[model samples]
Target chain A: MEFTNALSIATPELIVVIGAMVLLLVGAYGGDKARPAISLLSGLVLIGAAVASATGPLGQAFMGAFVNDSLAVFAKVAIYLASAVAILLGHGWMIRNNQARFEYPILILLAAAGMSMMASAGDLISLYVGIELQSLALYVLAAFNRDDAKGSEAGLKYFVLGALSSGLLLYGASLIYGFAGSMAFDDIAAAAAGAHGTSLIFGLVFLLCGLAFKISAAPFHMWTPDVYEGAPTPAVAFFAAAPKLAALVLIARTLGEGFHVIEDQWRQVILALAVLSFCVGAFGGLMQKNIQRLLAYSSIANMGYALLAIAAGTTVGVKAMLVFMVLYMVDVTGFFACLLALSRGGRPITQISDLAGLKQDRPGTAIVLTMLSLSVLGMPPFAGFWAKVYVFGAAIQGGLWIFAALGLAASVVAAFYYLRLIKLMWFDPSPGLTDPAPRDAQWVAYAAAAFSFPLVLFALGWLDGFAGTAARALGLG
Target chain B: MIAAIAFYVLAAVSVFAALRVVLASNPVHSVLWLITAFFSAAGLFVLMGAEFLAMLLVVVYVGAVAVLFLFVVMMLDVDFVKLREGFTRYMPFGAVVACILLVEMILISAAVAARGAGAHAPGVQHATDVTNVEAIGRVLYTDYVYIFQAAGLVLLVAMIGAIVLTLRHRPHVKRQDIHTQVTRDRKKALAMTRPETGAGVRPEDLV
Candidate 1:
């Protein structure tokens, strides 16, 4: 392909990259006062990128280093929009905390660019580059509040662990290249079909292990709770949403496009990670007192269901994974947005008890929070219910009803904590009214809550069709 | 014969230094050992005919990065003795992990030995006529240009992150207003004092 044609194929990522550099200059010259303007400009840039992605031609680019397809387009729209929400949430938060700087939004824009790369990555080299690009920005965002000891600690911990995971991924990629004589997914797939060797399986396991860390699947989930609790709430919202979706989609592409022929081998690894995630997310969440930590466990369990669907290694499974994540992504983004909005005594509420008597004073927020919690816990009539149904159905259709049953049982165990939050908000004694909700988070929470039940009813048909088409783009069934 | 012997000697010393980097109790000593390990590894790369890599391993790793590592280690207020105090307490757990990793490595090596790195030799092809830098340059720009640029963005993010974390503006502290100084008219800053040269400047004039 001509270089210009390849460049056209990656228009969305290019928009973000060039936009970030331009915004960096604006911020540098305009100083802190330029933050809000730069943020809005970046949002428009993202919208433009999304439009480009949705309308652009689909094909391999850069000699198959990148590919733009239905999967990439679908995932990019969700990620870019979520990245915008994250910037909005963080803007309100930094202003409230008196640490407003222009870099926050630019960092997020850069990270979104990285996520676009991940979604479109067609080769191991692109995969590693994308993951590192996303992770580097996040490490800085995690410690955005540098004065806070906990924030700095979170950043340092995430950076160290992220580097270690990158090492594992690189080693695995090298091994695969050594064995397969290729880096492109199509070539790797061809190589994998010809060989049923232990060395390849070993390399495959390591690669998936590295990816599992990205999605915060357990035993690799050790970083999520600390990072979520320590990082600024808005940054955590971004972490819990776009990056996870990008990683999950990347994993699906790798499995469906690259390692489809080695189903029995990679499936075991995926299934094992899913089961571990189920156990850890379920049992571990029961003991959490802090709200952020509880949400961390919730995300882990949600990823388990997604991974369970993915382990099926079918087109239906991939579709289910994509749908489940987009729904879960909105649920998590709104969930954290609510956390950003609610403050008791002018201090952001950290403890569960701080939410006591929340309904009495802040009835609207309380109800929205309740709706989100119920929706996320898979209560009937909510978006999460349908998400779970599709994933479980996919797993069963793939003849993995046993694992589906395990996921259901884990969901049962997980419901107790979600119920506990609801009970505290509605029934517990009054502490005090939370401060008035910030405009950004307030609007975000309302929009997210509306989607939690009724909007999903309206949008589910489109989402299901889009996700199906996206999954089919992987050339799997 | 000499090259083979030299490879063995470099490899042994490099491995020994790497072990010492981890096992040494003193943080400063460990850093120095890490630099030694880097040196020997660079020599090994040189022996393998990858002169470009050998240069990078020296200039990038040894010359720059290792010096920064040394600075951080020496500057940190770490209580190395206290840090190492938990060695005995966690030794059993650590040893179990170490053993598991060792076994896993052995298994992978065994698999590689039995199967001969599978379907092919390696992915990177070095032409006999082309120099190492030339081959790498061609691939870096054409085949993997997107990834190379993405890596540059990663470094750019690191730079932004350092500034964001460290840079703070203080309202009270005086700063250089070089632009203002440069645009100023000299008449305001300097007053003609022809009388002061003969009679000495009055205190009021000086003020």
Candidate 2:
């Protein structure tokens, strides 16, 4: 019975792993012709994994190393969905540029599997393993365009910094394990709940720092702009969407599950990171010419807003965090889709100036960019507005009025960059005649952007209920 | 008494070698010092009764990781002098950071030692008759199997990542497709018609 229970709990990850392996074998021998089929297969595999995870019973497996619960289900489904969209959109772009390789989808599948593991991780060992698994694939994906020196440099920088952060996290984990005498989240929480210790607090600090780096929050966010600017556009899109969700969920889980007792300590640290991220994200992008770098800063700031909910340390905070992640991912994927669609004379455009007079041609892409930009700016009736509402409202309920105020001010400042991009797309004259949407995959991305409109406007109640249910299931409520 | 003496000797050598690993001007020498440090650390592990970990340290770190370090250092043509040019400039800042870390570690360890009862839970008691390896194997294969498999996945991803990052496609290289070559028919290669006797097959006739 126990064996079957474990198998059932792990079915989703197993399906993804098996699918990836099969695709790897098929892709290896099938040559370049297999890319499209494999890409489609990988997408289906992720959807299947999501379904499996959602249908599973809520409980723990692997001696409490992996948790199968509403929270895990929600996070895994979101990750798989976002990753599937990335693969669907990225395939056509890669193929059009003669950069299509079977490895792209395989890596995505592996990365998704890692993220699903992270979503369900019930212990620190699982967390570290999941994180490393995800990051290793991401580092390769970031440097996918090896011919580009900047891409290689980005990969190297990400790898080195990521490894350093991983080391710090391990150190912190060891400290906690030493203090608590167990690596399990429940044990650590119990140990802390029994009596607070300085060692446990230090461990939590280091752990939070490591997670902050993962999410590219403030002082630890030095690598975000350069990496985003240099990595291939699809990889950047993936980076901005799914991995951020996974990392954010992991943070919520680590703090909520393992260190909830020390909320007084960790909340302050999170608050500092949140404030700094908001400031840097707001002020950093004002002078940026590169579109990717601008978005990177925007993402940093967005992370700050999400961290506000985390700082609240309440059930409402957890629910708001979930809703915000889903909405933010939608906006990120849509924005990247527009960027991916932009090309003139077969050369990819990376500059904010490149969008100048884009409204004249490729009006579909221009409009999509407009909506996503508005959404990112937290304009009312857009999805980002509600995402912000939940987070800010939760903060206020938790007596974190100062953070909410800081967030509101930061949003106003951050609006300028998002609006500037829109203005460039609409008002400014084209530096050269703009090109039409160049790839079939971009239409899929446009469809994604289109879907977000209804999602933001009509799906608000569903998102709220789902997030609330998941949070309640996790006992945060 | 003998174990204490052995532990002290290993600890001293390990610390010295670790210092040399950082301070050595040549990368190759640094790698060599790193190997020494790893070996002494393994020795210390043995002195602490973790035989499996000690053996693993020697096998994995000394055997594979140290060799990898040596390979990397040998492969790169680094200018040792240029690399060290910033040493003096950063020394004070580095020293300050080091001192802070040292203080933090000392404080943490001191506190942990003082509150020793809180450091170990009574729940993880093990049978004394079991060897370390046997005990580890039992738990790892049972309770930790999933995590162990996850570690394997990390390694697999690492391998794939390394290959994808370094492997380059040589566009100019032409390779034969054996399947196509073998499937080629005799009819496609040769004309079946009989040629006119004695006259050289005209180009049209050949076709």
Candidate 3:
């Protein structure tokens, strides 16, 4: 009976894992000939996981090591769906390049399963397991094109650095468990809320260091640009979307649920990270030529905003983070999708200047790419603008006006690069005609672009209410 | 007490062996030094009354891990000297990293020193009658069953990831067809050809 309840609560993750195993069997038997079917089935499985997450038996189970509350459900749905889009995007690119192996979709499916586990993680053990599962798959995806030297380097660097960070995280977890005598967040909270020790603070700081590395916050973000620049384009798109949200949600849970009493201590560390991330992301992006590297910097800056919102440590703050992340996830994925769709003379576009003649060649892709850029830069009439507004409002409400001002300044500097991209796309002389866009990538780009602008207005009311309910799930006023 | 003296001698040798493991110029020497360090660490664990953990340390780290390191060092023809040539070029960056680590260490020490006697655990006690292994098993089976499974999944992912990254199937390679092999019967296998007792079957007759 106990096992049944736990499995019932973990149904969404189980669905994804079981579906992936079944797909793996099919792929293994049918070989490379079954890749396309496997990819489509994987996407459907992710959508199924999202649906299950949405319609759920919301409760905590597994000895309170997993929670299926509003917050986890909301984050899990976004993660699963974004990863589904990633699978669709990868399928098209893989076929075009003849790297369409069946393992690709299954790896993605498993990674998505791991990310959902991160969303629902209620204890440190689940948290570490979830992170490792996702990361091990991603390390392979980074080097998916094993023949490419840059891809292999990216994979090795990511794996080595990621292992170090995991070590740091585990060390902190051990310290916390040693001090508190439990791995469950509630027990940590119960012990920490009363007679806290500085060791607990130290553990929290180390834990934050590891979590900050996950979001690619400044001072721990050395690997982001290289990994992004070197990984396959579709895989880069996947990296830019779901993993950031999963990491941020994990950070919020660890801080909000487990260490809220010491918010004063953790907030300072978060703010420092936020401030450094803002400056570094803005200035570093200005010098990047590779579009993937530029987006890496952009993600770093966006994480700074998410950190600022989290530093507020309020219900409104968590709500702001949710809004920003979901919106940003869509925009970034679309932007990369646009990159995936367009090519010049059969060569994939990797450089910013490669987009110069895109307007004349593919007007639809050019237009939508511009919309995504505007949305990410927080221009009016786009989804990202409201995301920024909510973030800043939360900051100001939490007496972080100075930080909000810093975010604005960073946004202004960030706009310079976005405009440079636009100027090149629209004004520069034609390089040459691009290859025709693939159906799947073209559609995903269009849908995401549409979501970033007109559709977002409709989504805003529902998303805000949804985000509010999720914020309330943490039991913070 | 002799227990105190044993602890000091073990600790000193462990630290020295660890330093040698890093500073050894030869890869083979490094592996040997690493094994020594592991042995000393296991000895230290023994002195601390964690005999089970000490046995595990020797069995896992010394017997398995150190031997694996030795195999990798001997089998791979990595140019260690060439690799170290860039160490000087990266000296400044390395120094900065070292300084940052130093600061972190100091700060942590300060935090602990400032909070001296107040740092006590909430207290996790095992029954005095049960061994430590049994105590661990009780929690692992009851409260941590989900975590144990999740860890298994993590290992599974790691295995899958390694295989995916390394495994490649070359196209056009001829392979066995199991279905064809298994479904063959006596009717398909034998033509019931009778040859003369001293004569060999011709190629056409075999076909």
* Top of the candidates by lDDT: 1
By summed lDDT, which 10 consecutive residues of candidate 1 chain A come out lowest? A193-202
Candidate 3 runs further than 4 Å off: B44-50, B86-119, B171-207
Instruction: Give the per-residue lDDT digits (tens) of candidate 1, residues A10-32.
Output: 99999999999999999999987
> Backbone clashes per model, in order?
0, 0, 0
- Residue-level lDDT of model 3, residues A1-477, one tens digit each, is 988988888888999999988998998799888888999899999999899989979998888999889999999999999989899999989888877788888889889988988999999989989998899889989989888899999989888989888888998898788767789898888767765545677778778888888789998999999999989899989998899899998988888899888888888999999989988999999999999999999999999999999999999999999999999999999999998998877778999988896788788998999999999999999989999999999999999999999999999999999999989989999778888888889998999999998999999999999999998888765
lDDT of 2 at B95: 92
* Model 2 agreement with the true structure over B32-85: per-residue lDDT tens digits: 999999999988988766789999998999999999989988999998789989
| Model 2 C-alpha lDDT per residue in residues A139-243, reported as the tens digit of each score | 999989888899998998999999989988888887788778888898889888864455698787778788788899998999999999999888899999888
Q: How well does each candidate superpose onto the true structure, as a TM-score?
A: 0.94, 0.93, 0.91
Report the error of model 2 at residue B200, Å.
Answer: 38
DockQ of each: 0.56, 0.47, 0.48
Please report the TM-score between candidate 2 and the true structure. 0.93
DockQ of candidate 3 relative to the true structure: 0.48
For chain B alone, what TM-score does every candidate structure achieve against the true structure? 0.80, 0.75, 0.69
| RMSD, one per candidate, in order | 4.3, 5.7, 5.2
